[model samples]
Target: MAERASDVVPSSAATSHSDRGRMNIGQVLDVLRPDFGGITIPKIRFLEDKGLIKPERTPAGYRKFSVADVERLRYILRMQRDHYLPLKVIGEHLEAIDRGLEPPPIEAVVPTVPTVALNSDGLPSAESFARRSDVRLSRRELIKIAEISEELLAQLEQFGLISPRPGTGHYDTDALVIAQTARELADFGFEPRHLRAFKTAADREVGLVEQVVAPLKRGRDSAAQGRVADAVSEIAALSVRLHATLVKNGLHGA
Candidate 1:
């Protein structure tokens, strides 16, 4: 008996969809790395650690990604680049979408242009407040926060990895956070250079927080500003507490 041609070869539409429907790990990285300015291996692993992208495993335990994964990654990268967001916030935004919840209002993309050298004054032209004086350094003098040098910090700043104040020659508290994050990364042989995708993530997170704060920003009254500040504080505290509780439950519960 002769074999049927349809059984032997897939239709063009079928082949097209096969290309679109799913991808393997390498393929996903190939598609996404360019979007991330060629992210490093450790950075991809970091995303995995944060539960941002989960790939299925084959019988041989190879990871496999789908086209939908690519879309999600695109959105994730978009949020990071345009919004000045952190990964946790980006993950939360994505989580709400995955749960069939409406995405919060779409926001305009902001810039990641590096800040200029901060003068002694430490205030941005737009912001009237002083550089946050509340930053508590553990030491009185320059400390070994990391092996990060002034030049490396400059590069990070140039990529907007760490934002700065206008007047303070030194970086703001967030720079310290990045330095600490860099320290952890160095243990894995990842450098300040390797993880700049975090700047993209940070840009995305800022938008999320801005959207959350937008309604509160509508009025100019002192009362309104206080309410906004208090609300932000409460939300931040609750977010941390909730994460801790959920992890504790996961560890202790059946």
Candidate 2:
């Protein structure tokens, strides 16, 4: 895939403005290195892709950062590290700052996203499991808690990996799980572009599940939907185990 324009940042300009000191991407990283260890060009670009900072462009199309820009980056990194706030919340804070208002405190109103739990018999219960599995997170909360870049989140959504509920604009626990998994993969240098295959495979798997369960769901009886739920849960668990086994075998073969 072609790299996005946001990823190919421009080189810094030679001259600085009289009012504010200007630095290129490298210089900006130097200033932030002490505070944000292991910071990289990609991460900075990711921030820019998320609209966290708006650096000026020189005539050569290089990115030029002012002192304020560096401080803004610091504030965003600090909020994420210190308060576990999501990027959406940080963006709001930045917006408030732009409006000349004090940003709200970092106390998160939404708790961290929850994990799914299986029942005693090693099977997902019809009622309790479905109830517990239903996790609704606002778009901002999903991005913040998942610690994923909005760009990556958008890609995931585009590929149907992390889908928000229809009409509600809120994501469920499955989306959270997918986002969390994607974030972990990103730490190992796997960008969203590389993860499209996983999404495609999952869609295929879901299609297979739907083939079997669609009939059960079509029934008007309440028990029919319950049966469909149970079927999906079983297939979900089996699919996870199968995927893990296949990956393990592939790695060993490699």
Candidate 3:
């Protein structure tokens, strides 16, 4: 027999009314339906079945959802609707949160280069270069979004031009940018092998920046750390501008 919504008790005599801020299945729907019009009891139950959520059960088998549970459901739904992330990926994010580790970044549904990366002059500023993006993409997602073939991605990985986050098996915004740039360069008959030089040059530039900031970073004060960050950002931005200007002149001379 199908269980009616009324069968679930929000607060029974056995369960203290003030025991906790718990909501029955019907109330849960009311709270979530505003944002998730399509959310149904079965859908919530399905999530529970998938181990994405765990709501307490009353002695009579009524489901009781807590505030935290509702928030978790909201997050899961938003990730699905906004980013098209798979349940497995969402589960991984929840697991990371539970373990007190930072989860992989969630890219905006419509992917684009971050506006913060550019200044009014149409060049990257120190703040832009210093700002870290919070975009993460799975292998397949990166390939499709970057419009690159699997073989090409493998080549990029081999050349160390792009890589996934250390332990997350997900690509960050830097990887996405590199992939897109490589694809565009491929039009000029440039392969990943040719890009290795750029990677080498980038590493050298990074080493220079690190040397400049090493002394500032040694200071234990917060102000010292702030200065270190500012120095790295400013120097990195300048290095990029210099590299771009040199390349432009070289191209014109060639």
Number of the top candidate by TM-score?
3
What is the Cα-based TM-score of model 2? 0.48
Better of 1 and 3 by lDDT: 3
Better of 1 and 2 by TM-score: 2
TM-score of every candidate relative to the true structure: 0.37, 0.48, 0.64
Stretches of candidate 1 off by over 4 Å are 1-147, 237-254
Using lDDT, rank the candidates from best to worst: 3, 2, 1
Task: List lDDT for all candidates, in order.
Answer: 0.55, 0.71, 0.78
lDDT of 1 by residue, 48-149 (tens): 778998867789977666655556666666667767668877775566455333334444121111233342443222121222443322221112444466
Top-scoring candidate (lDDT): 3
Clashes of each: 17, 1, 0
**lDDT assessment of candidate 1:** 0.55
- TM-score, prediction 3: 0.64
TM-score result, candidate 1: 0.37
Native-to-model Cα distance after best TM-score fit, residue 153 in candidate 1, in Å: 2.0
Candidate 3 residue lDDT tens string, 28-59: 77777877899999999999999999999999
Clashing pairs for model 2 are 86-144
